[model samples]
Target: MTMGFNESQSAFAAALLDPGLPLPQGITTARGVTDPLRFAVYRNNVYVGLTTALGQRFPVTKRLVGSEFFAGMARTYAADHKPATPLIIHYGDDFPDFIAAFPPAASLAYLPDVARIEVAWTRAYHAADRLPLDVAKIAAVPPERIAEMSLVPHPSAGLVRSDFPAGTIWSAHQGEAVAPVTEWRAEAVLVVRPAMHVEIRFLPPGDAAFAACLLEGTTLGTAAQKAFAAAPDFDFGSALIGLVGLGAFSAFEAFEGKLP
Candidate 1:
């Protein structure tokens, strides 16, 4: 009869997910009828809600794979992964990794990275608000110490690096596909919410290295040097302009005694 609280809960959860499972002993309607069909309605509702949440979070994945494939995939995903937290919005946190391991999706190697970018985009959208970097703060630092300074990234700053042209695939699915992705080169993606809207951007050859170094609290000189070594044609002045344009840095501080 599953009289214990813990055992009853386990039985109910299992039945709720699998309508074919018999209702646990001692559960009945007001009329004392054990109609297992009743549980099927709620089971369908739960899957529908969870699948909708996944669709919202990974719209690009849905678009690339088409609705039929995505729906089948989402249903399979829902059966195995239930939300532990009350907030279902965060349910698909491991969906990307799941896609990477799923046998049917083996052909779509970029799917995981695309999922990662979508996750980053949503996270950036919900990140805490913060003021952009005050350019005046850096101006106050002595010019000699500028190279030794470390800049703080904005609260919404996030990055995704993928070997499989993930950024290109993501961009292709954005609003009617402006252009095709002819070149299949590895790309690093930068995500930041400078204002209200989340912005996704692709980093140029050396910019990823520069941005990554800075993200790790590297001195400006070291980041630049590493970036330059990787791509001799790296443009420091242009990169600074782009960084300011994206409002990537939130603050600046002196980094003592550092070189690379």
Candidate 2:
């Protein structure tokens, strides 16, 4: 059957990741004959390239699972989740979700969150550059009006709240020798690239709740209230200053009336 150029291109692309699919019609070597062996080699190379890309994107995840196991799992993921765009960097946006649902990775409950952290790191690295909210401007606001203001998170600011020590695990993997994670507990991580470098910070006490509320456009007072509810010892002052120091906000909005 005759196929249009676009149709052939689509078929060829699909078959690259899916080895079960037959070679696209009209595909042949320079010798003018279809060679199944050559096509198999090409298919294998495509899977290898994509698996390598996933490995690079999720190095800690790869290290957590041995190279052999990761390669097998990555190949399976690439086969089902083909690239939506031509840009390789954008290929694995859904990988964290994939790892979460993948049966082999079910035993490692925290693996998904770790992948999410890696995903955030890559996104922050590529995010558009913007000037962070100036600390001085925040300090200048009248104390009475502070509660009604909403701080705008930077474009690269992302939160990863996990029930396990995902941030600690991720941080431990950054060094040459993996450090043991003695404390096993929930962790709320802030991933942001305010300037040249992407920074990862573990939020303390009620800071996560406060940051989450602020990111959702809630007023500072409301957010502080929520944080206090989450942590009895929540200090609104320290939390505000710390987040500003990390450059988590790009701008802020002030309301004339009292904010709930």
Candidate 3:
């Protein structure tokens, strides 16, 4: 009897995973060589391709774990979770979860958050393009109505809050300016791509709250109130200026059907 396609495919998959297994019947060997040796090359290539793709996605995580350890983790992760899509860029969505449950990485509680930040960075890099708000337009808003104004956050804007100092840790590894510190602290981060570049910045509690409110479609006055509530010394003017500097604000629209 002829083998069904599903059975044949299952055998092929098993053979790829286990080099000891022989290729399915009716599969021809190349150059009259043994099927096992030919299949071994294919299996090795599969591992190498997947490992390379994962490393490219999580370079920071790979660097943190070291080459050998990263390769091992990638192998296990790939075995457990095959890529659902053919796009390599979107291959590692489950990596953070995998790392969180990985036994060897249990000692490093912050590794998962680091993976999340890396994923966010990649997503921001591929987000749709948009022009940042013009500072002059924001400045032209009347002082009286400034509080009633609402600003749109860019499409790529995202906030990440973590108990660990993931933002600081990620920043330290980015080859940017660093400060001497021996202790870890809780952190909140804002990620956005205003023009074409993805930028990540550590945010203070109040600023993070304010940005969250704005991203949630709250009015400027309401968000400022929340920010002040979070941090009594929160500076509205400074926050506004900082957003402008970061290109966080896409455009300004008034609360009452008016345009800034």
Task: Please give each candidate's TM-score.
Answer: 0.82, 0.91, 0.76
lDDT of 1 by residue, 149-195 (tens): 88788888888889889998898788885477899989999999989
Note the Cα lDDT for every prediction shown.
Answer: 0.83, 0.91, 0.83
RMSD to the true structure for each prediction, in A, is 3.7, 2.8, 4.1
**Candidate 2 local accuracy as lDDT?**
0.91
lDDT of 2 by residue, 61-104 (tens): 99999899899889989999888888898778889999898999
List ranges where model 1 is wrong by over 4 Å.
Answer: 1-7, 18-26, 216-229, 235-241, 254-260
Measured by lDDT, the strongest candidate is: 2
- Backbone clashes per model, in order? 0, 0, 0
User: What TM-score does structure 1 among the candidates reach?
Assistant: 0.82
User: Best candidate, TM-score-wise?
Assistant: 2
**Candidate 3 residue-wise lDDT, 1-260, digit = tens:** 66789988888776666556777765657566456566778888988888899899888788788999999999888876766788878888889999999999999998889888888888778877888888888778889898888888777777777789888888777764545446788787888898878999888888888988988889989999999998998999888878767877778788678683
What is the total number of backbone clashes in candidate 2?
0
List candidate 2 stretches off by more than 4 Å.
254-260
